[model samples]
Target: MIVALTITKFRSFTIPFAFIGMAVLRLPLWLNKRCRFWKLMGSGKDAQVDLPADYRHWAILTTWDNRETYDDFNFRSFVMKWFNFFGSESFTILLNPLSSHGLWSGKQPFKTQISDINHTEKIAVITRAAIRFNKLKEFRSNVKRAAEAMRNATGFILSAGIGENPFFDQATFSIWENMESMKAYAYQSFDHSDVIKLTRARKWYKEELFARFAIIDSWGSLNGVEINTNN
Candidate 1:
């Protein structure tokens, strides 16, 4: 069970560089040298599509064995420094492997390595919802309906908590097998339609959406706790 950990941050040179050093370089090195990390790099730097300009300032995908290992690494590593430096906001997903998927285009950070891990074409659709402060309950209820419908469709992956964001409005994250599956659920489903209608009707959002497509390469616990990994 590889979990998806997606971190998005506003553009800042110092923070983004630190994230690469700490999470991609330092953390992996520490894990391989000090703990247990089954190192698997993707195909090449062109494995996936780059995030949209608006959202490309920072992002990363890493997998983990379980929550326990993730927790251990978080408390014991320099990873927190990256988060602190970037003022990061994150969303995580726990996925059950899907047999069919889509491939991300070139331009992604770790594109090459990603293509090697899971050659089968797999696409992931990530939808982020941010709601007003007092509308948490209503927003969640609506999102729950959409999630339920999406999960019922073929190629559905497990979805997790709509975690709170310290620096932004309420947030929710979900995973899907492919773009088609996501489209069917997002566009054709009745629940999703209602959510959209309500959102537009109420004008519940204070900001526009931010999203991206990424290929997960390899992930697992650095220490022993399960941490969400991207690929």
Candidate 2:
């Protein structure tokens, strides 16, 4: 299976149109039988979950049967057309799951089982959670510091914050130079590690998903800069 993630930035004045697309685009996506699962999400102000969403930015995450299926959707889907006309900039990455654990809305979205891939390969990580209503305050208090620590870590590339709802559902999509580099930050960074421990101790999430992917392809630009997924 292939996963396609697209992050688009709409013009300030066209924000309303982008909002409309979120509701309207669901129809065609649901009608496409080739698509296994999908999520239409809004973005955070920076690379981590934060108060006040980035009104001009949004994202779509979809799982497809294969590369051909994604190609067909990319070339002809109304979803693409909507972004092409309304978005000022966009970036998309095509991935194959390396390993996945936990649940996303009660289902496993990524199906790849290859966890023994080379450590030198570029890696993509997706960490998402449905925060418990009562734990929102604690979750928010710690996320920003962890996010800031990550940005200064070695081999870090880029990331975007995405979720179904700005408040309850939160997720982070990040890319790193390799597994070692990614693990270093995930395991060694004090702030991030502390937050991880707190989450388990406090039981902050109602549901969560943590998955890794091998970056197969990428295109377009984000904020006017293209990402080199292969390197």
Candidate 3:
């Protein structure tokens, strides 16, 4: 299976149209047999876990049958046409799952058999959770510190704060130069480590998913600039 995450941006004047696409684009995606799992999401400012939302940016995370199936939909479907007409810039990254654990909506969307991963290659990580309603305040209060830690870490490329619902359902998609760099931030950063501990001890989430992928292909742009994935 292939996972594709596409982030699209709209101009101020076109924001309303782009927001409407979140609802209208669902029909075609649901009808398409090639798509297995998908989520329509809104983005946060500066890719941080912020309380206020980024009105102009949105994202689509989808699991497909294969690269060909994704290409077919990307080129021939109403989704692309809608994006082209309303969006000012967009970025997409195709991923191959290296390792995945945990559940998303009670199901595992990314199926991976590969156990060994090359640590030197560019990598992508998706961390998402459905926060328990009771723990909302705790979850929100602690995430900013971790976000701040990650923003300045070495080997960090870019990240996007995305989710279906604001506050309660949240997720982050980030890229790193290599596994080592990503691991350092995940395990070594004091602020992030503290949050990790709190998450387990506090049981902040009702459901959660953490997955890592090897970026196989990427194209387009976000925020008016193309991401440099080169080593």
Best by lDDT: 2
Which lDDT tens digits does candidate 3 get at residues 96-157? 88888898888899988565365578888999999999999888888988998888999899
Model 1, 1-231: lDDT tens digits are 343453433334454463354346554535543333222111101111111123222333434554566556555655544543564343333333333122222111111212324333334443334456776556655665665676687755544322223222323344455556666777788987888899888776655342334444423321123434343
Ranking by lDDT: 2, 3, 1
**Ranking of candidates on TM-score, top first:** 2, 3, 1
| Runs in model 1 lying further than 4 Å from the true structure | 1-77, 80-120, 162-168, 221-231
Regions of model 2 farther than 4 Å from truth: 46-51
Q: What is the TM-score of each candidate against the true structure?
A: 0.44, 0.96, 0.95
Q: Per-model C-alpha lDDT, please?
A: 0.42, 0.90, 0.86
- Who is ahead in lDDT, 2 or 3? 2
Worst 10 residues of 3 by lDDT: 43-52
- Cα error, candidate 3, residue 86 (Å): 0.4
- Please identify model 3 stretches exceeding 4 Å from their true place: none
Clashing pairs in 2: none
Clashing residue pairs in candidate 3, if any? Answer: none
lDDT for model 3 comes to 0.86
